[model samples]
Target: LFAIAFALLRKYPTNEEEDFDRLIDNWSRREQPLFIERALPAVTPNNDEPPPDYHSEENLLVFNQAIADYLVTSGYTVSCKEFCREANISINDSADKKDQLEKKWTSVIRLQKKVMDLELKLQEALQEATVGGPTREKRSPGEWIPRPPEKFELRGHRDTVTHVVFHPTFDVIASASEDATIKIWDYESGEHERTLKGHTAPVQDIAFDHTGKWLLSCSADMSIRLWDFQTYQCIKTMHGHDHNVSSVTFTPSGDHIISSSRDKTIKIWEVSTTFCIKTLTGHREWVRMVRVYQDGTLIASASVDHTIRIWSLPSGECKSELRGHENVVECIAWANDSAGPYISEPIANGGTEVCSFLVLQVVCW
Candidate 1:
C-alpha cells in the first residue's frame, strides 16, 4: 500500500494552481473581443440592425449554442439549477417535465429594456471617442458623484436579510438574516460560502471584530452569541437582556461589546469574561441600533422613539439626545473624520455653499 501510494503521488503531482492561472490568463485574453462579439452584437457594424424578435426561441437557440460552445472550450460545467440561479430565472418545480418549456417571453421584455439602456451608453461612448475629445465629465473641488453599476445579486436568504458587514481584511461579507442564520459569502463573486446557525430566533445584526478573528451577533432571542471566525463555531452565548436584542457592535479596541435591545436599554459586555458589566437605560422605546465612535469614547444609538442619543463610555451616562425625526431611526453611524469640520460649523452662505449644495444635490437626485 505504501509503495502504491508513493508511486501514484509521484505520477500525478498536482498542477492545479498553474492550471488555474493559465485558465484565467486565457479568459482575460479573450474577454474584450468576446464581449464585443456577444454583448454588443446589436451594435456591431456587420449587424447594424438586430432581429426584431431578438429574444425569440429561434434567436435563443443561437445564444444558448454560443454559451454552450464557450463553456466547452473553457473547460467549465454548470447544472441547470446553477445556470437558472445565475440568470435570475425562476423554475416551475411543480410543472410536468413534458409541459415545462424554456420561458422567455416575459424575461425578454425586461431584458430588452436593460439592453437598450446599455446600448445607448455604448453609442454615446463610441461617438465621444470618434470626436477625439474628453469622454469624462469635469467637477469642482471636493465634489464627488458616484453611480456604480450593479454587477451581480446575492440570493439565498429565505427571509429578510437584516444586515451585512464586510470582513475587516478578507474578501468576504457576513449577512444576518431573519431566517435565524448568519451567512458568509464571497464578496467578489457573490457566492454563498457557508451558513452559521445557533440562534433560535431571527438574527437582528452582526459585526466582526477588528482582527476578523471572531463575529458577534444579536438576535430576537434576547441573547448575544460569539463565534470563532476561523473555526466557524459558536464560542459563547451571552444572555442578559430581558427582551429582543436589536443590535450589537464591537468597541474600537475589540475588547468589549455594546448591545441595544427592545427592552429599552443598552448593555456593555466584557468580551474576555463574557459577562454584562453595565446596562444603560434611557430610550423611551426600543433601541434600533447602536454604534461605537472611532475613538471608542462615545456610543451612539438610535431608537423607535424617533430620537438619537449619545452616551459616555464606562460611566454609561447619556450625554445628549437629538430629536425631531418623524419616524423611527433604525440605524446610526458616527461620521468619518472628513465630515467633522462641516458638521461642527454653523450654517452660512458662501460662494460654493458646501452644505446647501449637498442638500440641493440630494434633493434633485
Candidate 2:
C-alpha cells in the first residue's frame, strides 16, 4: 500500500486543466495495490477473515484516499472528500487511520526535500570546479627573463645606500647606508620598518646570517657589529681592521664571518668566540668587497688594485688572482653555486691567474 502511495505521489498529474477523471482512472489501473492482508500479515493482526481483493471498490477507495490526502497536503486545491466523490469512492476508513497515513506522508515529503537540497549543492560544486579550473603544483617554476621590470622602490635612506641583502626567510630587506645606519624595510610593500644606529661612521655593507637571526654590518669606523634581528640591538662588536671595514658576510654555516677592508686584508672571525681566526693578505690596494663561495670553501675579494683574488678558507692562503680589468675591481661574486670549475679553469693565454670569467647563471638580482 505504501509503494502504491509512493508511486501516486511521484507520478501525480500537475496540469489543473487536464481531465481529473482520466488521471484518476489511469492511476487506479496502473498503481493497484497487492493483497494487503496476505502480503502484510502484520497489518491485519486483529482480522480473522481474509480481506477483499485489492481491486475491489472498498480497497480501491483506501488507495485513492491516500493519494488525495498526500496531494492535498502537497498544495493541491481540491479537498480529500471532494476528490473521493469525483472518483466515485466511499470514505469508510476511520479518522485514526487517516492521521497515521498523514504522518507517514509527512515523513516522505521531508526526506524528499532533503534529497532535493543535496542535489542542488552537488550541481553548484560541479559548476564551480568547471569555472575555476585546475591549480598549479606548489613547486612549479615561474616565468624567467633577463632585465625584468622593477616592481617597486625602497626610498627611506638619507645617504647613499651601499649594500642590501634580503632576509633568508622573511619578507624584509636590510640595507646599509653612508648615513651611519642600517634600515630595514618590508620587501613586499616597500615600507620602512626600523633602523640600527650603533655604527659611528658610514655603513658600507650588511649581511644576514643563514638562519636570519643575526645581521652583520661593516663600517668606516673600522668596526664590524653584529645585531640581533629580533631585538634590533647590537650584541657584539669586533674592532681589528686598522682602516675602514669595507664589506662583511656570514659563511654558509653561520658559525664564522668573512670581512674585507681598506686595510687591504680579509679577516675571518669565529662567531661564537668573537675572535679573529685567520687573516688573508694579498691585495696591494683597498679591498672593495668580499663574497664567500656557496660551499664555504673559498672566498672572493675585489680590490682597488685592479685584481680579484680567490682565497682558501681556514688556511689563510690566497689561491689565485684574477686580473685583466684595467680599472679597480669594485665588486665580485660567484656566478653560481657550482662556479668552482670556472674559477679554477686555466686560461689559454699562458697566464697563471684566471683572466676570463664565464657566467654560469644568475641566481638573484
Count clashing residue pairs per candidate.
Answer: 0, 0
lDDT of candidate 2 over 99-218, digit per residue (tens):
555675466556556666886999978655643453345223332221234556778888998888999999999999999999999978978999889888999999999999999999
Model 1 Cα lDDT, one tens digit per residue, 137-225: 65443334322344458898899999999999999999999999999999789899999999999999999999999899999999999
**How many steric clashes does model 2 contain?**
0
Worst 10 residues of 2 by lDDT: 356-365
Error of 1 at 284 (Å): 1.1
lDDT of each: 0.70, 0.74
> Per-residue lDDT for 268 in model 2?
95
